[model samples]
Every structure is written in structure tokens, then in C-alpha cells.
Target: MGKKIILLLTVGVLAAYYVYTPLPDNIEEPWKLTWMIAVSKTVAYLNLFSEFLGANRFVNIAALSKRQEVPPTSDENVTVTDTTFNNIPVRVYVPKRKSVALRRGLFFIHGGGWSSGSFALYPHDFLSRKTAERLDAVVVSASYRKAPKHLFPTQFEDVYNSLKWFLRQDILENYGVDPKRVGVSGSSSGGNLAAAVTQQLTEDPSVKIKLKTQALIYPILQILDMNTPSYRENSHFPTLRKSEVAKGWYDYFTTDRSLENAILLGQLVPAESSHLFKFVNWSSLLPEKFKKGHIYKKPIHGSSDVAKRFPGILDVRAAPLLADDARLRGLPRTYVVTCQYDVLRDDGIMYVTRLQDAGVEVTHNHVDDGYHGAFFLLDLKISHRIINHYIDWLKENL
Candidate 1:
């Protein structure tokens, strides 16, 4: 065991040195050096180190895993209420401050690649109370059923049902909120759910309640094509990657792993889907402006097996960018935030174009120095500067 420990330590040091040396002279803006730091930390936590370092890595992982459950800070004014929304769990945040009548309501969804996140995983009660206090709004963060266990439509249904409950119970009136002033906001995968909920609301007339606006921070708006310029550039980026994003969607929607094989075989969609569906224009609808740093290329055709495995890829809810002109036109005012170095950046840009073209009011903020998962890192002392800027944007817009 002693000899093995020595050998493992030697190999780990060698590998770490190889990965760290010869760094790029100009890594560019939006691509921060901290990303490389995060990669190294991930490696350390994965137990790829030698026996000597194994204990340290295990300790680090344990600390991080534990921190995920720790409360953000001690505050007695913020109260968290855990209750069921359509049989799904949800957390509501109410500030202990005096406010004007009829406060604005914010429906928040937490992000975790659509599978692993929970209501308790986020400091939602804290952040939501802060936002509510500053903006004079009520924030309700829903805990939708995760994927692989609950599937795609299930998560969607859970959120939709929560919204219905919010409306049916006259929550706005009960909480002194103006029904017309309600809004929805989320980050990453939750951002995707927020967009989906908004889209679903556009077609549901039975619900007269209107969503005043939508706040999407680095949202994943499309799924059919993973070959976007950002995807190519950040395919292997830490925290989030094209392959991981694809795998996440597959795992969320199917009970069997064979769906992945079917998607690769082009069997997800029917042979006539090309003509039946408008994926060409939908996928290629990106604006020319965002293409400034992008190199244009013709899209390759998918295999038959690829279509069979993931047939639901064509659904607009799975790929909001594919929604028709009418639906886009009907959507409420939108605020989209994108990060330049993020893989899903182009999706936000293109969706903005589609919304504006469809005659919807749209406001956009592009975070040039940001990465995919940067928004959630705001609470960390080191990342507070950037995360505060995002919060400021939300405050101003909301």
C-alpha cells in the first residue's frame, strides 16, 4: 500500500503538471482563468489523484457536497414555507419588511441539468427574499420532479400545475399582488423551464392571468442541434458541456438508454420530418450579428437511427426556438441574459431575434466576461462582483 501510494502521487503530480503548463498567452475575455481552476478542482474531487492526494480530494468533495445543503446565511427575517404544488414540493419566500400593497410575484425555478436539483439545494429562500424585499415582489421557487425519475412532460406539467394553482387560489390577491405584475425567472435548466412555462401559457386561454415578463439567465432554449458555434467552442468546458447537455436531455426524457442509440441512428424523428417540421429555418435562424466571431457552415443531415431514438426532439417545448410565429408573437415582454463564453449563448441571441421579428418586446443583456455557470456562483465571495451585476440587472428589469 505504501509503494502504491508513492506511485500514484508521482503519476498525479505528472498529470497535473502536464495539464497546467504551457498555458495560452491570450485566453481571451469571457474565457476566464478561473475556468481552468475549476477544471483542476473537478479533477481533484474525482479521486484521480495518488493515494497521498486521495484523502485530500475526498475531503474537498465532502466539504463541497455538504456545502450544497448549508444555508446561505443566518437571517431571521426570511421565512421559508414548504408546501405541495400539484403534489410537487415548492418553497415560498416572504420578506419581513413593510411594503406597498399588491406586491409583484416572481416564480423561480432552480437549475441542475434537469435531473439532480431540489428546492433545498438552492439558497432560493435567501435570494428570493432579497429580491422580493428590494423589488417588492413575492418569490415562489418550485421544486419540479427531476428527469430520469419523472421524465420531460412530467417536469413541465409540475411547473404548469403550480402556476395554475397560483392562479386558481388567487394567490396574487391573497398576497396583495397585482395579477398583471407577476413574472417568471430562472437560471440554466430552470431558465429552460421558465421559458417552457411561458410558452405553454401563450396557448392556454382558460387561464386569463397574464405573465408580465420573463427573465432568462443563460437559458438552454433549443435541443435539436448541438453543433452551434458556442457548442463547438465550449464542447469540453467545465460545469456544462455540449455532450453533457445532450446526455442530460436524453436521460430526462427516456426510461431506456436505447433512446441515445436511436438518436444517433437518426431514428428520433420520422423520415418525412424534414418536410413536416421546420427545423432547418428554426436551427439556422440565428442572426448575422452574432455570427461576427462565428464561422458559418452547412448543417450535416442526421442519420435515420438518430431520428428514431429521440423523436420528441421535434417538440417545440423541448426546443422553444422552434415555436411558430404566432406563439412567439403572443409571448409577453422578455428579458434574456446571455454569457459570451457560454455554450448556450447563441440560443439566447437567436431566440431574441425570433421574438423581435414576431413583434414581441424584448430586452437583452450580454455578459461579455461570463461563462455558463457563472450566475449561480454569485454568492461565493470570489464571484460576488459578477453575480452582483446580474442581480442588478434583474432589479432594474423587474
Candidate 2:
């Protein structure tokens, strides 16, 4: 047993050596950042091997391998309520301070590659609490059933239903939220859902409640292109990597691990999806700056069999970037943050550009030194700087 543990550590050290996780001079406190990145990747690697040590499967309950499902209460600055909406668990955080009138409202979704975010939504994170107190807004965070344990549309359905419930007139009024001034936001995978839910509301004639604003922090907007410049450059950046993310998407779509290799080869989308290129094709939508001269080639349509087994991958609810102009046009005022060294960076870049082309108002901040999920490193100065900027945007838009 002792030898096995040493062998695993040695293997991890060697794996770390082969991967390209370098500290770019562009970033601040490079050594500290590298340490955090190393720890994050190592923990995730360990989680995958935990079965040997009698630990529960990491991807089963929460994306982070965390088992905490019990909701937590914040200190005096915020009032916390644990409840359900549309039969889905949610935590509402409202500032305890006195306000001039009804405050703004924000519907937030957490990210974990569609799996890890399951456990942290219930008033357990810092950003949501700060948003409620600092922006003087009522915030609701939904605990969507994650993938692998659940499945694709299930996570989307939970968020969509919960947002629809939050939009209810009485619900907003009860929380002292101004229905006229509400918005939605998320980071990474949650950001994808925020964009999808906003687009969904815009298209649904029955949903009269149009959101006022949206903010996406390093969001993964589509599954079509993993060869974007960021993916090629930052393939080994810590926390989120291209190969790992591709697998997460495949897992979210199906239980079969066998077909995921096809996803990596970029053929899992099948040939029929070529029609979606005009909307989500990064070659057309991404700015020349992001391209870095890598010409976009549509993934060859070679996996009709895999695509047929599960067609949900291309559903607009799963990949909001695939929505057409009519759906994109009515979207709310937007704020997008993209990191230079993150595999999914281009997802936000193309999305905000498309939103602008459709006449939706937009505010964008491209963090040159940033990597994916930077704000998740709560203790780091760079992370807090990004979070503060996001909160300030909420102050203006919400």
C-alpha cells in the first residue's frame, strides 16, 4: 500500500513535468499563481484515482468532489433563506441594510463544468454574498442537479425553471427587488446557462419578463470548437483544460465513455450541424485579434453514429451560442469577461460580438493576464480585483 501511494505521487510529478503550465511574465505574482494552479490540477487528478482509497467518485455528487449539500448561513451583513423554486433547491441572499427603495435583483448560477457546481450554490460562496450586500441587490443561487449523476437538459431545465420562478411578480416583491431592474450572471459553465436562459426567455412568448442585463465571466458558450487559439495556447493551463472539458461535455450528454474519443476528434457533432455555423462558427464571429492567425475549419462530420446516439449536444439550451439572430437580438444588456490564457476564452469574445451585431448593448473587459476561473481563487488579489469589477458592473446595469 505504501509503495502504491509513492508510485501515484511519482506519476503525478512526472505528468506535471510533461504538461505545459508555465508562468507567463504577463501575470502578477507568477509563482503564487502557479502554485494555486498546481494544487487545483493535482486535487482533480487525485479525485479521479480516489476509488483506490475507498473515496466516493468525485464526479458523482459535486464537481469539486465536495460532499457538502447542507446550506450555510452568512453572518449579519446578509439575510439567508434556504428554500425551493419550481421544486428545485435555492438560496436567497438579501442585504440587511436599509435602502432608499426597492433594490435590484440578480439570478446567479454556479459553474463546475456542469457537475462540480452542484453543491456550492446554497449560500456557501463569497461572491454571491458580496453582490447582495455591496450592490444592494437581492440574489438567488439555484442548486441545479449536475451531470453524470443527472444529464444534459436536466441541469438546463432546473436553472430555466428556477429563473422563471424568480421572475414571478410576487416573488420579486417579497424580496424587495425591483422587477424592472433585475439581471442574471454566472462564471464558466454557469455563465453558459445564464446566456442560454436569457436567450430562452427572449424566445418564449409566454415569458413576458425580459431580463435587464447579463454578465458572463470566462463562459464556455459552445461545444463546437475546441481548437480556438486559447485552447491551442493554454491547453495545459490549470483548473480547466481542453481535453478534460471536452470529456465533461460528453459526459453531460451521455453515460457512455466510449464515444468521448470521437468528441475530441471534433467529429462527434456530425455533418448536419454545418447549418449552425453562421451563428456559432467562431471563424465568423470571433474578432481577428482572438484568432491569432489560426484559420477556423469546421469540424469534419464523421461521427453520425455517435451524434445519433444523443442529439442533445446541439440543443440551443445546451449551447446557447447556437441561437439565431431573432433569439440573440432580444437579449438584455450584456457584460462579458474573457481571460487570455483560458481554453474557453473565445467563447465570450464571439458571444459579446454577436450580441452587439444583434443591437444588444454590451460591456466587455478582456483580462490579458487572466486564466479561466481566476475569480474562484478567492484569496488571490487578482481574483478579487476581477470580482470587484464585476460587482461594479452590476451596480450600473442592475
Among these predictions, the greatest lDDT belongs to 2
Candidate 2 global Cα RMSD: 4.2
After superposition, the stretches of candidate 1 with alpha carbons farther than 4 Å from their true spots are 1-67, 70-76, 122-125, 261-271, 275-284, 292-309, 379-397
Query: Residues 36-141, candidate 2, lDDT per residue (tens digit)?
Result: 7667666666776786677766443354545444455767899877789999988888898898899999998888888776525432357788888899888898
Model 1, position 20, has a per-residue lDDT of: 54
In model 2, the runs with Cα more than 4 Å from the true position are 1-21, 52-56, 59-71, 118-124
Over 1-398, each residue of candidate 1 has an lDDT whose tens digit, in order, gives 99999999999998766555222333332234454555645565465454365464334543554566534332566556777766777777766667766677888887777776556665555557667666767778787766676777777788889977776536667766778778888878888888988998888988888788888888887665566777777676665767668777787778677666543333344556555334324345666655656655434456665556555577776677768788888888888888777888888887888888899888887876566766656434424554455467656655
Cα RMSD to native, each candidate? 5.5, 4.2
Least well predicted 10-residue stretch by lDDT in candidate 2 = 59-68
The residue pairs that clash in candidate 2, if any, are 63-116
Taking the candidates one at a time, how many backbone clashes does each contain?
A: 24, 1
lDDT of 2: 0.81
